[model samples]
Target: MNDELSLPATELVRRTLAHAKRLLPAALFHHSVRTYLYGRLLGEQRGLRPGRDYDDELLFLGCVLHDCGLSAEGDGDQRFELDGADLAVRFLEGEGVASDRAQVVWDAIALHMDREIAERKRPEIALVALGAGFDLGGGPERLPPGYTDRVHRVLPRLHAAAVLHDSIVRQALENPRKAPPFTMQGELVRQATGGSWPTWEHLARSAGWNDYEGYRP
Candidate 1:
């Protein structure tokens, strides 16, 4: 317990998870915990010290609540990311957390889906995205030895990626406005509904794709 990064059992964390579990599908709740575990591993690999380069509490809050926008309470006119960020921020504020710390969590959750921007931000923000990206893309071979096993043992794989992807597609299908053109959500909807082939997936697997004409790295 001393060496490992354990999820705090504070009342706040407990209540937050309770609320998330109530709204999010079982697959999503497991996804959130896995995201936090990945973030913890990333923090260690980067030599981040507790209470300095990163705050474990904020990291947990950001990673666990990152996908909360998909929850019913998180739905709004804006994208799920923004809606979730706003919800997390308000929740933190209600708990009397300082505005600055609350803002870091907001940034992490809101930018988790945007790797390019999130990477250039604070460690808290970058780790959130890195964690989610790693988990969604499947466990990387280079992750710390036994780290993946440790996380998986505590939070077993629930095939959340497929569940989440379907949820996003369903949301977009229900409200075309939910998925704007060219965005990830829009692309998912397009592919799911057979509007177009999955060229994006093809390009992702292409060899030396950056060298292709009109391709930007």
Candidate 2:
């Protein structure tokens, strides 16, 4: 734990964990923690260093709080991503985080769902998206040797996909405004409610990477 993850042990970290654990569901809570772990791996793989390139604590905060909108406390009228971003920003501000840093985390949460822009941003922002996506989509083989088992051994994924999907779908069902077309929640609701919508994957392939089907990093 000390060498592999080296998770920050600040008071802020403690408060952040407590806040998230109280609000987020079991699956999401686990997924949030794993997001930090995966984000760390992604950062290392991309030659980014903690403290110098980005604050590890901020990265941890962003990853853990990224899905806050799914929680009842963070619920708001905007897209879950934006609502979650606002929730996190408020929390960070209350905890005395610098304004600029809070904005970065806001961007991290706001863009976590974006497959297009997040990867091109700074490490703190990019890692949250890349790591979250990697956790939810990519297989263990995509990571370095033994990394997946190590991460899972610490925090097992508890039906994350179904739990997360159901949570988002349920919210969108209750509040149609929460699911605007083209957003992740909206598309998910479309698929869940049996409505017609072009999937992101279909669009991505049409946009060109179709020839790189089996390509691996």
Candidate 3:
């Protein structure tokens, strides 16, 4: 096993996992661990050295806690990404993490769902996005032989995406403000509301559909 995979988790990391286990569903808890494993795997492939190019503990915190916002306790009035980021920042600060390092974790959680942007942010940001995408079926890449089996053996995939989607839609239904424009939550709200809300795509395509260039009505 690689050092990142085999090394023991720190107190903060263990605490975060324990807290997630209590607050999040079983599938999500496992998914969180899988996310961290995937991130660590990608980091190793890229030759990133722990405590040098990156902090393993910090990366673990970012990946494992990335989806905390989806839980009822972590769900705030903002987008789940932002809420999760806030939760991570608060927890890290409470654990005496430095401001700069805590910010790195915050950025990783906040931008994991945003494609291209997250990849361009930094190594930690890119790793979290890469890990999450790989887990969620983003594309086919050849991992180390037996990597998938080993990881899945420890952390089973429990159809996490579908369950998470349902929870997000439910949260958005309860509070329209939670679904901002052009966001994942916004799309979910639109879907849940029978397409009543016009998405940015719909609006853009229909902007001048029935209007003359100089006409104002």
Best by TM-score: 2
Summarize candidate 1's per-residue lDDT along 1-217 as a digit string, tens digits: 2346478667878877777778788788888878887777776778876577877788888988888888888887667788889998888899888999999999999899898999899888888998888888864437767877777776767888899998787767777777876889888888887786446646665765655567567
Error of 3 at 180 (Å): 2.2
* Candidate topping lDDT: 2
Candidate 3 pairs with clashing backbones: none
Q: How large is the C-alpha RMSD of every model relative to the true structure?
A: 7.2, 8.4, 3.8
lDDT of 2 by residue, 49-146 (tens): 89889899889999999999999998889888899999999999999999999999999999999856988888889889988888899744357778
lDDT of 1 at 108: 96
Query: For candidate 1, which ten residues in a row score worst on lDDT?
Result: 1-10
Error in Å for residue 214 of model 2: 46
Predicted structure 1: lDDT? 0.81
Give all candidates' CA lDDT scores: 0.81, 0.87, 0.80
lDDT of 3 by residue, 125-213 (tens): 87888888888874666688887888877777888888778878887888777787668888877776767666555676688674454
What ordering of candidates by TM-score runs from best to worst? 2, 3, 1
Q: Which ten residues in a row have the lowest lDDT in candidate 3?
A: 1-10
In model 3, the runs with Cα more than 4 Å from the true position are 1-4, 199-217
Number of the candidate with higher TM-score, 2 or 3 = 2
